[model samples]
Target: MRTAYSVETVRAAERALMARLPEGALMQRAAAGLAAACADLLGRVYGSRVVLLVGSGDNGGDALYAGARLARRGAGVTAVLLAPGRAHASGLDALRRAGGRVTGADDAEGPIARADLVMDGIVGIGGKGGLRPDAERLAGLADRSRAAVVAVDLPSGVEADTGEVRGAAVRADLTVTFGTYKPGLLVDPAREYAGIVRLVDIGLELPGEAELEALQHADVAQLLPSPAAESDKYRRGVVGIAAGSARYPGAAVLAVSGALRGGAGAVRYVGPAGDAVIARFPETLVSDAGPAGAGRVQAWVVGPGAGDDAATVAEVLAADVPVLLDADGLRLAERDAVRGRTAPTLMTPHAGEAAALLGVRREEVEGARLAAARELAAAYRATVLLKGSTTLVADDGGGAVRVNATGTPWLATAGSGDVLSGLAGSLLAAGLAARDAGSAAAHLHGLAGRFAADGAPAGAHDVAALIPEAWRDVYH
Candidate 1:
């Protein structure tokens, strides 16, 4: 897993590491890594024009020191000091000694425009709200500049803890974060500003568990289910899906579509639309009885166009298995009943449903998706997946929340969410934790959506049919 700690955690870790090392050692390490990355971007260190947008804190110190390193390597470096008196004394001295020129904010615009690269050091962990007036102007100039921008720590003006951009934030072509990943670097809004992220280890030992994480290929591969030679159908785990109705048989088909392709031994369908589900997926075991009489299952997928049948939803929820709730299930759910469940519960809600659950406006949920997901997880005491452009999954226990970056906007098609619900439920049956199952399923669903569409518009069934290809790609 690619772990992301809050800014406070990073600062505390940095302090502990700093106490052990010599003064300015951490800054030098950060600068060295920054300079090296810039050199790589420039293709050659010699004669490269580099501009540093220096702020008042350690972030500016990192840029100034990096500027000194670049100057010594035969690059033309200029530091645009936003706060001249408050600049890091040692870092500025180092830059001057290395033949780097320092220019005031008044002289920055022209230099920034002509530079080959710009280093953004306007804010760091200490930063609160958006850019100050002068910094915003400089950032606007950088935006118009032909230069490639590299942000130190994180793109300035983004909330380091929440990934929310309070005001104007620098859009960096690349961000080189020190020690570990920050929440802003992994979550959206801020993630959108940070084009690509690179982590530079400063030898800080992180403590305990992370608050957030981004899943990598290896991490997902490890979490994925792989059948063993000795395993039987029962040993591989079974998933039961309670979805669709006479009015919406497509929901059942779509849900079974995902469950059938998932790495489960068998998929049991129990709903009014069993015939339709079986027609689409002959591999599924269709049952006319409700979820209560569906026999044994490791996990249950509830909702997905079951309409307003409170009794059906309650039966599924009462099952002694990990449950994934979605669609109309989210609407008809008794909040306390879900919270009282013995088994792990995962709630997948779109912005509208999430808004209803939280008693807030849909716009609020959309505006700050990370906050919404976390709030839902805390409120429902369940793993919550807020589906959107940047899908967020949060564990109820305040552990690592994940934001899936693999999906395409084309996934907005009808009944797509039903497929995701079934897929996640299947993974839950396969013995993955709720958070892992939800995130992994979201990732797979997204890849399948993209693969099915392939840059064109695709129907929900197309996305469902592409699950096997997506599963193969993940394993391969």
Candidate 2:
């Protein structure tokens, strides 16, 4: 699992490590790693035009020291001091000794213009809000420069804790973070600004639970539900899908397509589009029996294309089995019935659907996805799967959220969510916790989406067809 810690946690760890070392020891370690990463990016350090956007903190000191290392190796390194008066005294002295020149903010233009690389040290995780005028001006120049931009710690102007980018922020081609992964580096909005991230260990020991974790292959392989030789169809688990409508029979086909591949022994589909479902997936036990009348199922996935079938959604909500709701069912289902259920409930909603439930605008949910997801989980008293560019599974029990790392922009097609809902429901039937069910389903769904869309556009069915490949890839 790829884990992330909050800014506060990282600061405490840094302090603990700093206490055990000499005054300049920690900074030296950070600078050495930073310089090495820069050398790798620049390929040849000799005669490389390296410009350092130096500010007034440890971040600037890190850049200045790294720049000194580059200068000693024949690079034309210039440090643009935003705060020349408050610059790190030792760092400046070291740079001067290594033949690196210090330039004022006004003199920054020349070196920055023809630079082969621009190192942003104007701000760090401690800094907040938009860049100052001088830093913003340099950030603008870096944006227009042919030079590849690399950020120290994180891209400046992004909220380190919230992953919220306000106003102007440097969009780095690569970010070399020290110690641990910050929350912003792993989440969206600010995540986009950090193109590629490299972590440099600085001997800081961080304990306690992480704020977020993205499941990797080995982590997921351990969670995959497998059957024993003695297990029967019912013992393995039965997933009942109450999706698809007369108007949208395709929803049934896609949802069943996902359920069939989801590790469930059988898929019992209960909907109006029975003929359409059987035509596509003959393994599905087609039935017109409502959710209440459908034979025993370990879990039920409802509302994919249920249109106005509020009564049907209500029946499923009252069922004792674990329930997963999505799409129109999210809108039509009674809230009290869902919250009052004895069995676990998982609600999957996109930004718009989340907004409607929260009584906020879609942009509100999109902007603060972590907060929105947590709020939804708390309000509904159920596990909430907020699906988007980065799928998050937030639990009502309030633990570290599960962030899906496998998604692609290409997954933004119609009817794709229906597949995810069914797959998650199947996992729930297989006895995974609500959180695990949602997280693993998203992991597989995202990988499948990537496979389906190799480079071009793909439909919902294409994504569903590749579910087995995604599952095997995870286990392999």
For 332-371, candidate 1 gives per-residue lDDT tens digits of 8899999999899999999999999999999878767788
Q: How many residue pairs clash in each candidate?
A: 0, 0
lDDT of the structure predicted as candidate 2 = 0.90
Best by lDDT: 2
RMSD of 1: 1.9
Could you tell me which residue pairs clash in candidate 1? Answer: none
lDDT of 2 by residue, 250-333 (tens): 887888888888988899998899999888788889888787777999999999988999988898998888999999999997
State the C-alpha lDDT per candidate. 0.89, 0.90
